[model samples]
Each structure stands twice: as structure tokens, then as C-alpha cells.
Target: MKKVSCIFIVDDDPITVFGIKKMLKSVASCDDIQIFQNGHEAHEAIKERLKEGKIIPEVVFLDINMPIMDGWEFLDELIALDIKEHITINMITSSIDPLDYKKWNGFKNRCPYTLNFKNKPIFKIEANDLGCMDIAS
Candidate 1:
């Protein structure tokens, strides 16, 4: 399997983005990770990259509960732009509300690029966590 290079993380907190990038580096999962303090910046950056014919991120870590442009708002804008055909978006939130889970589930179906959902403050990326399945017969 080919290793992914580009990573785009969107969140309102700078510290959170720093922590996520640090953790990913600690695990050596990726060498290049882009950080955006807000969804508006992330969206604009992604759009520019798309126009430049650059490959989008294989993994996106999104945080909910942001100002001006929350995760869902960003998702809507992303869908409207239609530049995430090959990208996988993973919701990384701290909320434990059942409704949040339900919304993500529904969004996964409604959105074209949403791949999965998970809580934020992640420290590791397990093979199983990335949706790798074993097939034996």
C-alpha cells in the first residue's frame, strides 16, 4: 500500500492542531501535515490546491464546534465545491452526545467524502482504526 503524504487538519484551536501534528509525528504516520486554525482557511487552501491540480489529502481530521465555520458548515462548503472525490474526512470531536454521533452517521451517507467519525485528541492511528479489514477464506 502506498503511504499518504498530504494531511489537512481543520480546527479552531491552534493547540489542538499542534498536538495532533505532534502526535502523528511521534508515531511516524506522516511527515507532511498542514494545519488550519479554522474551516474557512482550510476550505480556501483546499480550493486553491485543487485549482493547482495538486493531490488532496488522503486523510482529514476535522473538529466540531468552531466559530464562523463549524465542521458541518465546512462540510457543506466542501460538498458544494466538489473537490474531495478522493479524500477521506474523519470527524474528530470531543462531544459524547448521541446526537453528534447520529449526525455524523447521517452525514457519512449524505456527504460524498466523509469516511468515518472519531473523537479528537487522538494519539495513535491503528491499522484497524483506519478501516483495514482482513479477509480470509
Candidate 2:
């Protein structure tokens, strides 16, 4: 397992973000952790970082349901950017709709960076299962 340099949590749910952050802190060694309320904000920030030649997040936890922009929309925007960085995206959503899964599979096919499609409320065990280790060590 490799320690992630940076991580992004793109979800409108504060509780979900908090839980994920706490779990990440406990299980993974990440240098930077960024939180965005929606996909739109995350997308914009990523573009800005790219423009400024700054390091983008290596991993992203995205939620499918959001006010401004949904996870799928975010993935579309990200693919459009064609960023060269090796980013791994995990789809974390509460949606039980089968369509969501289908869409996620389609996105995974289109975007090689996508890693896992997980249900909401991520826990420390899930993080460990994802193989998050301190690569810096």
C-alpha cells in the first residue's frame, strides 16, 4: 500500500465528509485533505490548481447526489480536462438505484482512474481495505 499525497472529499453531506475525514486520519497517511461541498466547487478548484501548476489530489471520494453538480457530472468534467496526474476516484454514494451502478461502471470504463464504487458512510475498515498506507514511510 502507498500513502496518498493528497485526498479530496466531494460531497454535500457534512456528516459524511466528517466521518470520511476522521476515518482517513485514523487509517491513512495523507499529506493534504480537501473538502468540497459539491462537485462544482471541486471541479473549479482542480482546474485552478492545474492552471497554477499546483499538485492535485491523488485520491477523490465522490458522492453521486449533490445540489450543484453530481458525481457523474464531476467525472465528466474531470475527463474533459484530461489531467495527466494519476488520480484514483472512489464513488461513495447512498443511492440504491441500479442506474447509478451502471453509470459508475460506464464511467470506470471511460476513466481508468476510477478505483471503487462504495456505498455511503465509509469506515476505517474500508479505508484499510482500500490499501491506504503511508508511502512516505
Lowest lDDT 10-residue stretch of candidate 2: 128-137
Most lDDT-accurate candidate: 2
Q: What lDDT is reached at residue 132 by model 1?
A: 37
Cα distance off (Å), candidate 2, residue 94? 0.9
TM-score of each: 0.81, 0.88
**TM-score, cand. 1 vs. native:** 0.81
lDDT of 2 by residue, 42-116 (tens): 999999999999898888988889988998899999999999877878888888899999988888788957468
Q: Show the colliding residue pairs in model 1.
A: none
C-alpha lDDT of candidate 2 relative to the true structure: 0.81
Q: What is the C-alpha RMSD of each candidate to the true structure, in Å?
A: 3.1, 3.1
Tell me the spans in candidate 2 whose CA falls farther than 4 Å from its real position: 125-137
